[model samples]
Target chain A: MPIKSMYVTYSDSIYQFIYFLVGDDELAKDLTQETFLKAINSNPQFRGESSEKTWLSKIARNLVYDHFRRKRLLKFIPFLHEHEQIDYTYSPEQWLEAKNEQYELYEALGKLPHHYREAIVLRKIEQFSIKESAQILGWNEAKVKNATERGMKKMNELLGGERDA
Target chain B: MLDSKLRSLERKTLDEETKNSQLLKLNKRNKDYMKKQKFTYSVTLVLFGLLLFVFSQTITESPKSIQSQQLTNFELGEVTKAYYLYSKRADRMYNLTSPFYTDKIFTTDPAVLNEFELLFKNSEWLPFNGDLTKYTTSINYLFQLENGESVYLKEINEDGFFVNPNTMMQTKLAQQSHEQFVFYWMHIYMGKNEFPPWKIGLLTILLLIFVYAAIKSNKRGTIEKNSSLINLSGLGLAFFCIHKMNEWLGVNHLLTLLLIFTFFMSATVYLHILIKKQEPNWKYHIQRIFMANIVLFVLFI
Candidate 1:
């Protein structure tokens, strides 16, 4: 695909990925800009390896992991409460309904180990197949399936319900 | 129970956010790359120009003669009446009855040996015999003859032939008596003369300008300015002037003084820049220039 169309197609997905990982709108916007610049400058070997969207998302995920690792090393606690009051672009009624579910899920997800959360997100939310999720997370298919199952079981227990059929 | 909820939530939201974030990261990286490229190109151009200017200056200057003019005049017999005249036609064979000879008439005298001893002793009055075997001992000896003449002797060792010191001295004296007229004529042309003090002062001023310009060009960060090239050229010209002044004036001490001042000024500027982490100020620059001038003036005067 041409560079311009690839950027236009993947920009939103990359931004959304960073926003979910970091939970900050502004930082997500900055990271999205940085990810596209990297995509444009990267070698053409990327064209054969994966779809442009997947390649960009991988770069964004690496950046997000780096940010978290640095924060952990520096003992920084990001001010999450500051983001609680802002009105998102989505309507309040639709947002609140989704946000309540998101907030409860995020809380339960946060309680799980990082690997389980990542595997579950990639497998279920991103709707990647078992093999694709394994490839993205650098794990085998069985490990991804196990983490996804554990993450789902833990979330059901936290939400006071049985696992979804 | 809770694991299912987290899994469902991750499924619903992560795709949208990941796409949006990647775009933003790529944009920022591009800007940083462009800025770095510009800085690299500018530095390359400045270095190239400096190299070109240095090459052009070197090519334009004429090659200088290392042999002193006094030495040349002495060889030409322009000052002294005595000179060694070698003729391919007239005196190719031995002149068997010359007064300087203690040989058996014209036959090769094994006992008298060669006339090189008489020539070596009397070289002060003569020009060089131009023989490698005559100067087989020491190259830079002065021999004074009874005729109040002098000659400079250099020892040249021909293959396996050695001229002893006594014979070397005598050979040099005979050569000088024969070459005295030519040596004196060369001496008048080779007279040592001093450079005017004003010319040395002017060169010192020019060198100061170059040092000042180099400092200023570095400060502006655009040493791309042509004035910097001109200033550097001025420095080369000034150095040449100092060299010529030393030669003309026969003042070797002045060259040492100039070198010391140049070294100190360069070191001072380098240390100030490294330690302060800033460009040299005008006050320090001017003070260094003034100090260099004072040193130059004292040495030259």
Candidate 2:
């Protein structure tokens, strides 16, 4: 498929995956752009081992991991961004009933370890099959099953419910 | 709530305008990255070549010759003439020949030259018809007099050659001659006896600027290959400078070992930086490990 068509097809899924992985809209947008840019530049040889969605998700996941590595390194030198203020302006009044619940679910998702968060987001929210999630994560199917089960249990605890609905 | 909300969000997509703009930005960045890589590769090749030239010249040139010119071989004959003139020789000896001393001046001391002239007047210059295989630091010249036993001439520095009258006098004569050679090449170049504050300050400032630029460029998510290669060559040059300094200071074996260990530690860190920018494939892992070992081996040598 042409890159533009693929971007059109997959950009939302990719962005939402990154947004939940890291709880920031601007960062998710940046990483989404970076992910597509990497795909365009690398011209990866798609051997049909996984679907294009799985491939793009894998790229977006790697980009997010790279971003987190950089952030961890920056944390050592706090003085570098001393003047930059973090925005925390999301008021409860602005969020509708469903948006507020989704927001709380993501807040809990962001607290999970990267593997657990990725497994939960891919399986529960994105609703990818276990085999597909394993293909995207470059993991075996068994590991995906374990991470998803454990991740969903933890998410339930954090949300104070057995199920979201 | 989760399944319904996810279904509602699933319909969301970037608008056409935002998608087009992001594509445009990606294209621009890709072009810029390619241009930067081309520039970096060219600069790295040029800098590596220049460093190689400088390294070769440093090995060839005397440490003191940068500050003051040493007399050439043709001019060394002047010292011979001065020696004969001072000795008031009725007839100049034409057969006073040295094997490696053909053009290179052995000594500038008038007294030693006169003594050689006097010795030459009485004896025929038996050419040291021995092996003339020249080495970096010293040359051994062996000649036999017509009546006297053979004398071995060993030339070390510009003014530190010794004419041993016989095999028994070789060690003793060379020691005395070395003490009186009157040359301090190391002290002249490295300035161990004096410190130049301005030079040190200027060098430090330039180093700081180079490091700052490298760090800033690296943080922008582009690891220019040229900068890394330049750093690799710079590390080599640092190793060379430290070796020369060690020679100058008459450093002991233990200190040399310590300095070498520190250099290897730094080189390992630098190798890690070079490898970190590469793709994490099996080929990359093998290449990274291979290159690191090669770097450490080269530096150790």
Q: Best candidate per TM-score, number?
A: 2
Interface RMSD of each: 16.0, 8.3
Best by lDDT: 2
What's the alpha carbon RMSD for model 2? 14.3
Judged by DockQ cut-offs, the docking class of candidate 1 is incorrect
lDDT for model 2, on a 0 to 1 scale? 0.50
Poorly placed runs, candidate 2 (over 4 Å)? A1-13, A22-27, A34-116, A123-147, A154-165, B1-11, B58-126, B130-301
Put down candidate 1 lDDT per residue, B210-294, tens digits, no spaces.
Answer: 6687565433222324475665565566455454444333232443454566578668767765754433333334345544654
TM-score (chain B) for candidate 2 is 0.35
lDDT tens readout by residue for model 2, B1-301 = 5445444543234567777888788667766655665566567548746854654343333321112123221111213322111111101111233111121113334565444434333322222323323323353333333344333345434344332222212222234444432232222233433436764564455456556755653333332234665455445545544444333332333244445654664465456446543212222232233334334433433
Against the true chain A, what TM-score does chain A of candidate 2 give? 0.79
Chain A TM-scores of all predicted models: 0.74, 0.79
lDDT of the candidates, in the order given:
0.47, 0.50
Runs off by more than 4 Å, candidate 1 = A43-47, A74-99, A163-165, B1-301
Deviation (Å) of A133 in candidate 1? 2.0
Which window of 10 residues has the lowest lDDT sum in candidate 1 chain A? A83-92
